[model samples]
Target: MTSSPLPSGHDVVVLGGGVAGCVLAARLSEDPRRSVCLVEAGPDYGPGQQGWPASLLNARALPRDDVWERHTAFYRIRARVLGGSSCVNGAWNTWGSNADHAEWTRAGGERWSAPALEPYRRRAVDRMRLRAAPDEELSAWASAALEAAGELGYPEVDMGAPGAPGRGRPLLNAVDGVRFNAALAYLDAQVRARPNLTVLSGALVDRLVVHGGRVRGVRVILDGRPSTLVADTHVLACGTYGSPAVLLRSGIGPEAHLRLNGIRCEVDLPGVGANLSDQPGVFVPRSPTPELDAALAAGEAAGNLYVSRMLVRAAGEYCPDGAWNLHLLPTAGPPLFGKLAPGRYEAGISAFLMKPVSRGHVRLRSADPCEPPVIEPAFLTDPDGRDAAVLRSGLRKAQQLADALAELAGPSDPVPAHTLSDADLRARVGTYWHPVGTCAMGPADEPGSVTDGQGAVYGVRGLRVADASVLPTVPAANTQLPVLAVAEMLADTLRA
Candidate 1:
């Protein structure tokens, strides 16, 4: 691999041009004196590329779009584009609560607690437009589910207004009505126009160049051309799969696993790719109101109106470090009550069961960079059974909510005509696309940990990972905001 030297060894070379990489690069490059480079394996967005709505529907319809299509014991989807998964995912905007970070500090370390996260949260909010649902308007169908949940005695949260009847404001991470991608939000005209900042697409990074436990450069195969790029500080924002795999190819990862694959072990870090977790979620389909059915029949975006009226309700003290988010997204598809035809008009009440106690791991299948990694989610792997138990309970809660709404509106039967026994639910329960924690950040006291809270790789200078992969556990909400938050934090740390 041969190529030109960098204008000068960069201050930071961020791998992966996804949300985390983009945000970190943009923020780090804010000072004109510093240089940042973002490299992505996929093509950048263009007028020729499909729009957000089309991408969402395609993934929803084609099983291939879902990560579960891999059939590799774990379910995960990696976007091979400039914007990464955010470019093609359901453009739902949400943020993490103090409760979310507090749980991380508890499970991982105090450095990650809600208190430690306050400054990052402030910066994240400052970078975007945030709105909270009003008191009166918050009592919608989703809220009714939270109330019913409280009546059932599962933990809930009431931030302020009232205790018994839990209430929450729906926070969206949007700028105007358009979606807010880190690449878009962080890369203003100033950053985009910088000559020092090089955003390269189609640059497939094969491995990191490590010498004496420090990263010296990156190996890449760009557009079928062999090349090498050197940098002062290398950031592995390539994400969970890409980052860990790169490590393995470069003779890093678990000792035993590397030997089996005929590769020398450079870093005997067992936790290089372990403790994988994803929030369990099953679609709770809802039969549409007649008016809604008619609108959908006319080919309109059916569930959007209901989503606009959504609210999250909870009770009890916020877990701080436990499950803290309850997002109520309205999806138009087969009813949660039962399966429906393509012509059917329905909605899905998608919920993210954050604070999963379950954990899994990622391993290299072979030495080939073109081959995908072997992923074992070890879903429901926790001995406590807390994750599975909550999801089972949520399924029942969704059924109840559907029934209550059906009774009020009269839909023959609110539940799907298909009978989903407890057995079926247990068999079908899966994830809501929030996969994290393969490479976790923790204090030295924690075994098998990979990086520090600042995202710097332990024992390895000039190398860092800034993405969902660093999370020790999946949060109880969408990962978009948290990923962005960490990227921003990494930027500040790099600057300091």
Candidate 2:
């Protein structure tokens, strides 16, 4: 590794140009005096959506390109682009229940409260250009699903902010089938024109230079050359999987685990890679009638065929009052993974356990920064089997909705989802892609707390983590909008 000389280091160096990193770099650089640098491992398409690839810009389908690893486990799918997962996600945005905020407030303080964060949430919404799915965007199947939810007594509620559990359309960050990613939203031409803001693309962060309990600089491999970039403060916005792996590689995690990887331990933060929580669910396939298939195909030809436009937030047996634990999603479109004969479509309802108690971990395979981390989602592995039970309840609820839509689409399998054995359910489980809680926030004295309420690393000065990784608990809804709001709030804290 070669050390790069700098007469004066940057005011702040953000070590991942994902959603949060884009927000931090943009907001912090507002002051002309503060020089900020944002580093990303992937290519930056530059400026706007014009220069971006069609696959990444299309909001109708989730693109597999620009991801960290291809043909890997579904749960491990994470985007490796300048805009992070925002560049490849479903473009849906929904807020969690009040119970989620309550949990966050307990772990972090009043700042995590919904009321306290409302301004930032609104800021994120405006910046991301989030809008409700238009009526024209709804296919015949989505329209039928909405009617079915109403028949089941699920009242309509806005999915964009805090509210009671009900059925409604989620806000979308896409406009006219174009995905407006974080990079395009935050780093516009005007922002990129700022001389103080530097976006270093195709630079992989090797590790941080930690000494005397502070991060002096970060070592990165750029264009096959190792160099150190000094900064007065270092912020980790590497998302859940990448952030913890970076810390472990820098010898800032558990002593035993670091030693096992042949890396000397610096700070023994046992929680650095622990408490990995994510939402898991199962999709119950339904055979669409000829009429339904034709309608979906027509909608596709019209360029308005969205797989999932509406969802129902249903309370499970284990859910608390005024809160939901399951998301019943109705989808009808081309198969997400494989091809289907023309005019034939895949239709199903997925039951996702929103608030699961099962925990997982991310461990280092080796000291090499280029190697992928060992990620175990550990879904439905709670000792009391609560996650499995709740998921079953959700499945039963999904069956009810499907039954209501029997005229349009019928269950493919004779067996009901609720009747599936635990082993069978485990084999069929899929993720919602909302992973969090790896670098959880809490008091410095807490064993499982990697950062404090304001995102400062517990034992390391001049270092912080501001992303999905620091969220102590995964919210009950999709994580994209919440992550954007979190970055906005943390950027304010850094400014203060």
Candidate 3:
């Protein structure tokens, strides 16, 4: 985005234009007096309009980013568009559960509870204009998957219907074949028309300009030129990865680690990039049957059948009383709108291992803001072996579902759970990309918490975090709606 003549100084500055960042910025700028500046590391395509890349705007397909890498073979897919992962992800509105909120309340007080945050989730859904994909919209594969779920004793119900737990249709954040992301839903033309908000896309925030134990401004790199955008209050809404990396780069992390990374430690908060967690998932795919292929071909001709159905449940020992701990996303049709093959027919069940106890970390490779941070999301590395156990059960469940499909389609095949041992399952684990808890929240006395109940970074002044990085643990479901709720709560608490 071209630099405008907006004032350099502002009352509030929100960094990162992701889901939480977009909503937080838009919500905070409603004062009509608070001069808010939003900084993003990606391109701003204005709103949903033509000439924008079809890869990013296509709701039925997931776009890939070459820049988002990790320390392992598993790819970390994060969108670089203004709406962040909300733009690229399978725009499902799974609000998690009350048990999930109980954990949040335990870590960040009662305000983070589900009862307190349910209104925000509703408001967020209303703003995003989410709707449940109708049962008729289910593809042939999805229909058979649902049938298999019923055969396996799983309930056929709406996955996000509050306390009801079972497999059913998923609520999607899309409208008319387009993704209703945070940028379009919250920060649209009407919201951006407000004079108090100045959004600067393609601007990289290098570090926080901390002076006298308070953030004065941010050292930003815009269009390859360095500049500083001064503000009284600075909020880091840069999701799980970018948020903590910004803190570490600003010398607000573990002293020795920051020093080892060739940076001076301004604050010895050890939890800046610690306590990272993510949902590990795997895909068990099957070759499509002739009937499934024919049905898909018909849908392909008509541009219909965007099936986003799922099975949310507590498969094994992590079973809670009223909530699910795992998600089995069984989908049909081409992956990424024909990115895999021209007309290849396939079906896959994405098994998500939620309620994971494994924790990870994000370390800065160097002080350069452009250099990607060394992300170490140690998936399935739980010491208690519970994570692997849960994943094994979920994979077995997915294999059973796949087996049901194979039986209906006339090809009996074995997936990883049927063929490989539990030890093998450990080697081939991948994330659902729902990374959270890098900058966890807790009391100051605790060792791993970087923020308090109010998202105030411990020992910092006029600075706070308003993103998924502040979550104490990864929620039991998709992180989009939960992360948006976190931002809404922060916006309600943060001063003007």
User: Relative to the unseen true structure, what is the Cα RMSD of model 2?
Assistant: 2.2
All candidates: CA RMSD (Å): 5.4, 2.2, 2.5
Instruction: List the candidates' TM-scores in order.
Output: 0.80, 0.98, 0.94
Using lDDT, give the best candidate's number. 2
Worst 10 residues of 3 by lDDT: 66-75
lDDT of 3 by residue, 137-209 (tens): 6777777777778888887665544664677766788765676778887777788888888889888879997
lDDT of 2 at 143: 91
**Alpha carbon lDDT of residue 390, candidate 2?**
96
Query: How many clashes (backbone N, Cα, C below 3 Å) per candidate?
Result: 12, 0, 0
- Candidate rank order under TM-score: 2, 3, 1
Question: 9-106 in candidate 2: lDDT tens per residue?
Answer: 78999989899999998999999999888989998998878899999999998899899999999999998988999999999999998899999998
Model 1: residues with Cα > 4 Å off, grouped in runs: 1-8, 46-74, 106-111, 130-170, 173-177, 289-292, 295-330, 333-343, 348-352, 408-423
Q: Residue 407 of candidate 3: its Cα lDDT?
A: 51
Model 3: pairs clashing at backbone N, Cα or C within 3 Å:
none
Ranking of predictions according to lDDT? 2, 3, 1
* Global Cα lDDT for candidate 2: 0.92
Residues 196-236 of candidate 1: C-alpha lDDT, one tens digit per residue: 68777678888887888888888887868767778888888
For TM-score, the strongest prediction is 2
